[model samples]
Target chain A: MLDSALSVFRMGRNMARLMEGLGVTLEISVVAVGLSLIFGVPLGLMMAGSNRPLKWLLRGYLEFVRVMPILALLFIFYYSLSKFWNINLSALTVSIFVFTLWGAAEMGDLVRGAVTSLPRHQWDSARALGLSEGQVSFRVIIPQAIRRLLPGVINLTTRMIKTTPFVFFINLPDLLKVGQQIVEVSGLRYPLASVWVYGFIFIIYFVICYPISLFSRYLERRWAS
Target chain B: MRRARFLIVALALALAMIVSVKAQAGDLDDIKAAGKIRIAVFGDKPPFGFIDENGANQGYDVYLAKRLVTDLFGSPDKVEWVLVEAASRIEVLQANKADLVLANFTVTAERATQVDFAKPYMKVALGVASPKSALISKVEDLKGKTLIVTKGTTSDTYFSKNHPEIKLLKFDQNTEAFNALRDGRAAGLAHDNTFLFAWTKDNVNFVTGIDFLGDEDTIAPAVKKGQTQLLAWVSERIEKLIAEGFFEKAYAATLAPAFGPAVDPKSVLIEKLN
Candidate 1:
C-alpha cells in the first residue's frame, strides 16, 4: 500500500501531464451532458409524442446508435460525413454531435418511459383541473417527471462521462492517454508505476463520477419516499 | 461412486483443455509446414502501408515485407498479410498475431526492451509540421503550444521526454491529429517525416517544421524479443536489402511523389555490416 501510494504521489510530472487529459474528458462529458440536457427531453417528448412515425423514428434511431460501436461511429463521422458530404464538422464537434445524438435519444427514451410510467390519473387530473397542454408539460408533467427524470439523467450523465475516455481515439488527450505516456516513459519500470498510474486515473474518474452516482441514488430514494 | 468418479475425471479433463494455450497464426513450424509465413502490417498509413483504390494493400512497407518473406521461402506468395493498427499491434505480436512488424515502427530504446529489433534499417526521427503561418521550426517553438500527435506512438514518447515543456495533445488517428494542426487548435503535429509528407500533400496548408530531433532514431522491423532465430534471419536480410539499394528504390517508386525524392539516400540507408 505504501509503495503504491508513493508511486501515485511521486509521479507528479506524469500526473500533471495526465491532468491535461482530464480536460478532454471534461470537455466531451460537459459538452455531451450539456447536449443531453438541452435536447434529450425534447427527444424523450418525441418518443412520447402522439405521432407514431416520430416515435418510431426516435426508437429506431436510438436503437441503431445504441447497437453500433462508438469507435465505428467516430470513424464514420470523421471520415465519411465531412469528406463525402462537405460537412465541415471538426473532430471535437463530431464527438459532441454523435455523443449528443446518442445521449439525447437515450435521454429522450428515458423521459418517454418515465413520463408514460407516470399514472394515467396524473394526466387526467391535470387536464380536468383546467391546465393547458403546455401547462401540463412545463407546469406539471416535467416538474413531476423531474423527480424521476433527474435520477436517470444523472445516471446517463455519469455513463457519458465514463465513456469520455473513448475520445482517446479522436486523439483528445484524456486520462487514459496520460497513463500510456507514463508507461512508455518509465520503460521497464512501467509495470511498477502502471498500477498506480492507472489506479489513480480510475480514482480520478471515480471521483468525478461518484458524486453523480450518489446524487442519482438520493433522488431515487426521495422519489420512492 | 463409480459414476461420480468418471464425472469428476471428465470435469478435470475439460478444465485442463480450457487452460491449455491456444495456437497462434505466427507459429513458425506450423507456418513452415503450411508453406506460408503470415505477417502483419498496417493497412492505412500511406507510403508505409495502405489499401489503394482497388482494395489491394500496397506500400513501401508491404513491398519490403514481401521481399523479406521471398528471401526466406523463395517466393513472396508464401507470405500472408494481416492488417494491424496502432492500438492492436503489440497485442497482435504478443498473441502471435503477426510474425513480424515492418510497419515503419520507430526503434525506440524503450520498445527495444520489450521487442527484438532487426538492425537499424533507416535513420529517422520525429519531426514537426504545421501550416506555413504557424510553422514551428524548433522544439522550443512548440513550447506553450499544442503539438498534436498520434496516440500510442513514438512521437508521443518523443515529445513527452525531450520536449517536456511543450503541451502535447494526442489523437488516435493521424488524420485527426493532422486535422488539429490544420485547424490551428494545435500548432503542429509531431510525427515521422513520411507521414508529414503524405498528410501535407492532402492538407497543403502545412509543411515540415523543424528539420527533426531526438537521438538520431532508426526505423526497423520488430519481432517479439527472444525470437533469436527469426531476429537473426531478418537482420541478415536487412543487410542484403541495403546493399541492393532496395530501400532507395522503394522510396523513389512509392513515396517520392508525395515526399519528393530523398536528397541523400547514402545517409539514410544503414550500411551493410556483412
Candidate 2:
C-alpha cells in the first residue's frame, strides 16, 4: 500500500524525492483548476449574457471538451503542434493548455447555468439600488454563485489529480511513472509490486482530493444551514 | 475511511490480476511458421515504424522488418506490423498477436528470459538527461536525484543495479519517459544514449553525460522462446547487416539527421565464433 513512497524510503533518497513527485501532481491539478475557474467564469458570464451566436458557440465548445477524452485531446495538441509547426512546447505548457481548455469549458458551463439560475430578483434589487449591470453581476450575483463554484473547483481538482496519469501519455513522469520505475528497478518478482506502487498513488490522490471534497462539503453544509 | 479502504483493496486486487495475466509466457515459432511475424512496434517512435503521410508504416524498424520478411520467405509481403505500447509489447508478443518484437527492444536478463533476443542492431549505453533547470554535469551529481525510464528497457536494469539509491520515474513508453524529463516531472531521464541523443539533440541546452554506466549494449529484435531457426536467422541477418553496413546506410539515410552522424560501421559489427 505504501509502495509509492516505499522505493524512495527503501532506496534512502532524500525526502524531497517523495515530495517532488507529489508536487508535480499537485502543480498540474492546482494550475488546471485555477485556470479553468478564471477563464471559465468569464466565459460562463459571456455565455449567459451574450447573444444567440455567442451562447451557441460557447455551449458547443464546452460540450466538446467535456465529452471528449482528455488523452486524445492531449495527443492532438502535443503531436500536431510540435510536429507540424516545430514548436517545441514544454510538457508543462501542453498539460496546462489541454487542461485549461478542458477546465475552462466545464467552468464556463457551470458559471453559465449558475448565473442563469439566479432569480431575476437578484439583478432587479441591484438595479433598484441604482447599481449598474456590472455591479449587479459582481456585487450581487457572483458573491452568491462563488459558493456554488467552490464545490465545482474542488471536484475538478480531484478529477485532475486522478487523470494526471494521462500525463504519462505525453511523457510527463507524474506519480504513475514513478510506480512503473520502482517496478523496473526493484525487480522483486511480485506482480503485486505495481499494486503496491499504484495503490499508494491512488491513496496520495485520495488524500489530497478527499480533503478538498470534505471542505467543499463542509462549506456547503455550513452555508446551507 | 472504512469504505475507502475496501475500495482501494478491491481496486488493487483487480489490477494485480490484470498485470499477472499480461506477464505470462510467449511463443515465437508458432507465430513465424504461421507464415507472418507479427511485430510490436511504436507507431510514433521516430526512426522506427511510425505512420507516415500515406498512412503506411515507415521508419528504420519497418525498413528492417521488410528485410526480415524477405529473409523469412524471400518476400516482403509476408510480414505484419502490429502497433504496440510500452506496457503491451511483452503482452502482445506473449499473446501471439505479435510473433517477435523488433520495436527498439532492449536486451536485459529479466526481459531476455521473457522473450529471446537476437544480435542487437544498435549499440548504446544508459544515459542521464537533465533539463536546463537541473543541468546535470556529473554522475555523482545525480546521486540523490530522481530519473525516469521506460519500463522493460535496459535503463531500468542499468539504473537498478548501478544507482540503487536514486529515485526513478518509470513510464510505459519513450514518449512518457521523455515527457517526464521534458516537463521537470523528473530530474533526469535514463535510456539508451542513442535515443537520448536522438530525442534531446534538438534541445540545445541539454547534453549527454560522458560517464558511461557500463559496457555498451546493443538493441536487437526479440522473438519468443524456442524459435531456434528464427532466432538464429535473425541473429545471423543482424550480424550480416552490421557487417554489410546496412545500419550505417540506414542511419545515414534516416536517423543521422536526428541523432547526428552514425557510428563507424566496423565498430558496431560483432564477430561470431563457433
Docking class of 1: incorrect
TM-score of each: 0.48, 0.48
Model 2 whole-model lDDT (C-alpha atoms): 0.69
DockQ of every candidate structure? 0.02, 0.02
Clashing pairs in 2: A171-B176, A171-B179, A171-B180, A173-B180, A181-B170
Candidate 2, DockQ score (0 to 1): 0.02
Per-residue lDDT tens digits of candidate 1, residues A1-225? Answer: 567547644554555666766877788889888888788888888788799888787789999988998878876675455333334345578788778878888888888988898888898899999999889888878878888777778878888887776765643446686565555344233346667777788898889989888877887787788
Could you tell me the lDDT of residue B51 within candidate 2?
46
* lDDT, candidate 1, B155-234, per-residue tens: 89878887788888889986687667767887888886656665665556777765466656788888865667778888
